[model samples]
Target: MAELSGRFRELQDVTSSPTSGVPLSLTQREPEPHANNPPLYDGDPNSCRAFLSQCLLVFALQPRRYATERLKVAYVITLLTGKGREWGSAVWDAGASFCTDFEEFRAEMTKLFDRSVKGDEAASKLARLRQGGRSVTEYAILFKTLAASCDWNEGALRAMFREGLNFDIQDESRLRLRLRRLAPHSSWRLEETLPSKSHPPPQSPLAEPEPMQLGRIRLSAQEKQQRLVQGLCLYCGGSGHFALSCPLKAKAH
Candidate 1:
């Protein structure tokens, strides 16, 4: 009996933490994630819609065990500005009742924003997406983001992207980009499919010669050499048939 009691005491001591005098299960637990600060967002239709997306992303990215939809919406409202600033106040009424679902609050904000929000506007923006000064990758991102709200299939989206591409990109490049996206089975890349400019075009046999003046004749290399040696200057020393017409001479005044 005495030995059993001593062994049980030793087991208890081994399982407990010596520094804090607490069991591992009770002591080793992490808190739910909560943002100390959220990104500032105005109530504009364009920027606010993007802000809502970011707010949702923050919750997804953070490590949390018991975070609620209500908490997420509350955090999002805290960062609102302009007309958005008043929304935080109006969220709670006299009885302190407020929206509990994140989706409901997001929808409410969408309706509340003054300008045209993400619907037809989003589709229109995607249709008109152009590279302009932006890179192909950048244009792809903008188009894809706007396209999320639209119902375009892969082929139609590819066609739209090609139509809005910068004029500097050759038709071949636009075709390559479109083909790669349209054909799911084949493997192709923009970087790998670029045209090589290293080789010069072959000279055409039927190409026209440049027009020359009637009185002046273009000289052959052999004819010019023969004429160059024939000229001897008693005055100024120079070369070529130009030397024959030299008006320059040494004059003692």
Candidate 2:
């Protein structure tokens, strides 16, 4: 019992020693300090308020430019959200920027949707409104909303219809009918013309002098005999006698 206690004490002492077993130096190496400063993660309401205020200021100071840019930015954000790093980077490289306010951005997005839902039927409605001298911007805004709210293809057809309807009424009807026919196969927008399926016909070569072969054939013996033949010639397969004695009836007869 005495010897066993001594062995146990020796084992405990070895484990507790700084210089023994598993090399204390290996475990005691000092940790390297971080290169960056500690992150300042302020969970306070004040910090959030300040950040939001700055964004609002930026938005308000340049609403028009920001509005235009924000439209594109919002589209990018929606595309990138929930995607992996590779997809996010792809979108970023593809010219997508971040928008500070999604709500304002969405309001603009609604305009596009509204236009699409109207499909190709909005042209006459828009024309009537236009002839009545309604505010063009208001009319445009209504169209925009319609465009933003619907499927991309549908919106495009609606826009094309509106554009076609803007021309002369008679021409507009033909254009509208064409658009209606085209709507199923394509999503053509009002802001642009539809692409043609085939190129224009090539121009013909310049005129040339008649060929010698054709000219000679025109004055050949056969040709002269054909000219001499009268009505119902037999040799030339008509009902007259021979080409030499073909008769001519008097005009009075």
Candidate 3:
């Protein structure tokens, strides 16, 4: 601890002095623009990983700017606020040895602030998730987000996905299964035959209703023969037209 404190003091003195005879690499660095700075973290456990990940990305993109571990750690310190700022400020003021190592700093921050059990949390949420009124696309997107962290096998994922779907979608899936079992690329059109509970087909206004039929009295064979001989209609026994062009038959249709 004493050696680390002395090293920290030496670094501080070397940075503060203009001609301390320190190596060029140990000298103070010029200020850079903060346009690419990561979002400020306020010690929210949920956002800790995301904030650190952004900082890492910035460091990766501009390696020359953050060449030293201290520079990387200092840059992250500047972005902290709230409880995070207090922690960073205390570490910086005390000149902690870990502050000179970015990897150690990151690991410490993760251990301190990251409280989430990602796989367990994801699995719990996925177990309770339901499609409800949402579309299949929307449901699938949400399901996939949780499924990524669950580490479940493909069959388990499929079962969970199907279980979360709306009742209507489940019914359609069952119909699809039946169709597949009947034939590959079956000709049966379930969608056309079965109407949706949400939206039923509308009746056409232009369609005509069937006309009522009138019962005819029984006629003897001689009467029927006489009607046929007289070019009369056999259906109604009308003389104006034959059975093929009968007005009563057309009217009955």
Deviation from native of the Cα of residue 237 in model 3, angstroms? 72
Deviation in angstroms for 205 in model 1? 26
Write candidate 2's Cα lDDT for 69-103 as tens digits.
Answer: 43333323323222222342453445433333455
Runs of candidate 3 with Cα error greater than 4 angstroms are 1-35, 132-142, 167-253
Local distance difference test, candidate 1: 0.51
**lDDT tens string, model 1, 98-162?**
45776777787877773543566665566556679986667766766676676544444444554
User: Candidate 1: lDDT of 251?
Assistant: 19
> Which parts of model 2 have CA positions greater than 4 angstroms off?
1-132, 135-138, 152-156, 159-189, 193-253
Error of 3 at 167 (Å): 4.7
Given candidate 1, what's the lDDT at residue 227? 34
Instruction: Give the per-residue Cα lDDT of candidate 3 at 162.
Output: 47
* Number of the predicted model whose lDDT against the real structure is largest: 3
Ranking by lDDT: 3, 1, 2
Q: Write the per-residue lDDT of candidate 3 for residues 1-253, one digit (tens) a residue.
A: 2443454455455545555565555324654345476778989997798799899888777665666788778778878888998898789879889998999999989998876447766676776677788765566667666766766654445444544555444466565454344335424322222334564323323334322222333444455434544555556766765444456656655
Candidate 1: 10-residue stretch with minimal lDDT: 244-253
Please provide the root mean square deviation of candidate 1 (C-alpha atoms, Å): 25.3
